[model samples]
Target: MTLIVDQSTINIQVLFMVNKETKKALIEKGAEIIYLKGFNNTGINEILEAASVPKGSFYYYFKNKEDFGIQLIDHFLVRFLSGADRRLSVTKSSYIERLRVFFDDFLEFFKGNGFKGGCPIANFSLEMSDLNENIRKRLDTAFDQMNNKIALFLEGAVKNGELPEDLDTGLVSNFILNSWEGALLRIKLTRDVYPMKLFYNFVFQDLLNFN
Candidate 1:
């Protein structure tokens, strides 16, 4: 006996994969809007409209708006950390030079974005830190991971004699991240790149100078 499978069943399976892709696209679009507009200011309809995704699709993928926000935070951090890791891993540059290049690259990126949205982690922390515990935890984890990466690079700099042997890598890492976040906020407020330039000059030229 021969058995036949229904074509409709195969189509349903394909549709399932398509749905998953669509859901992820919506989440990414939501992340973009969140960066441009704060969590409280963004509405579901607005996200759906910007994403060009149906309301049913959003509901199918996420449990609610808050769940979408959580996923968005995770998504941004993954991209952010990956980019930083790649930039920091460049072999041709010293650790100090790598750090300067990374800062310059981001300064250009913020300027390209018109200085409208600050750092995503900083944006969420300012808006959701007190309001949402889950998001707060997510931001905390992002900070720890990014700070650790910076410290690891700083330690390498010390070993390479690019930085002082007695330099406190961990402390310097925290200060750098904190200062960058603060500079981003000021840049967004002033709609000027001066704050970023100041930060780069101070951190790279003054604070981290070993020569």
Candidate 2:
């Protein structure tokens, strides 16, 4: 037997599809806004307006503002991690060289953006961690994952004899991540790229102890 779907059912499905698209667009727009202006300063209406989505649509997609914030954090983390992975996996560069490329790319990003803001993770960690447990946990996991990737690189460096075998890779990884975050904060505060350049130089010359 053949079955037919009603026009009303088709219309409802189409509406749902449209609503889902609208929601995705709004979430993406909200993520950009949050990255630039921050979580505390961003307003729901502002996000909706920026996205050009109506209030009904916004609420239909997200339970509340905080829910959207969480989604934004997840999206940002995925994108950031993917970029880092690509940079670290470059075929032509040595493990140590890839690490240096990572630092150079970060500093170049700051310079290219005119140092208006630095790392989104660092920004969100400072702003959202104090007020939201859920966001704090998400940020913490992302940080740990990032540090682990760096540790893996450091381990490769040690195997290649680029880094000393006796060094604690885990501690060195955390130290680099922590120091970079601090350096980004200083660069943002100073509105200058000097801090980033200095940090990059120090990481290569002193921290990594590259010969």
Give lDDT tens digits, candidate 2, residues 55-171. 666777888777887787778777767766887778677777888787777778778887867788778899989999988898899899889888888998888888888989999
Clash count (model 1, backbone only):
0
lDDT of 1 by residue, 2-115 (tens): 899899999999999998888888888788888888898999888898888876667878898888888888888887777778877898989988877777777888899999
Model 2 scores worst on lDDT over the 10 consecutive residues at: 75-84
Off by over 4 Å in 1: 1-13
RMSD of each predicted structure: 2.8, 3.0
Q: What are the models' TM-scores?
A: 0.89, 0.85
Which candidate comes out best when scored by TM-score?
1
Model 2: lDDT of residue 75: 80
Clash list (residue pairs), candidate 1: none
In order, what lDDT does every prediction score?
0.86, 0.83
* lDDT of model 2, residue 60: 76
Off by over 4 Å in 2: 1-20
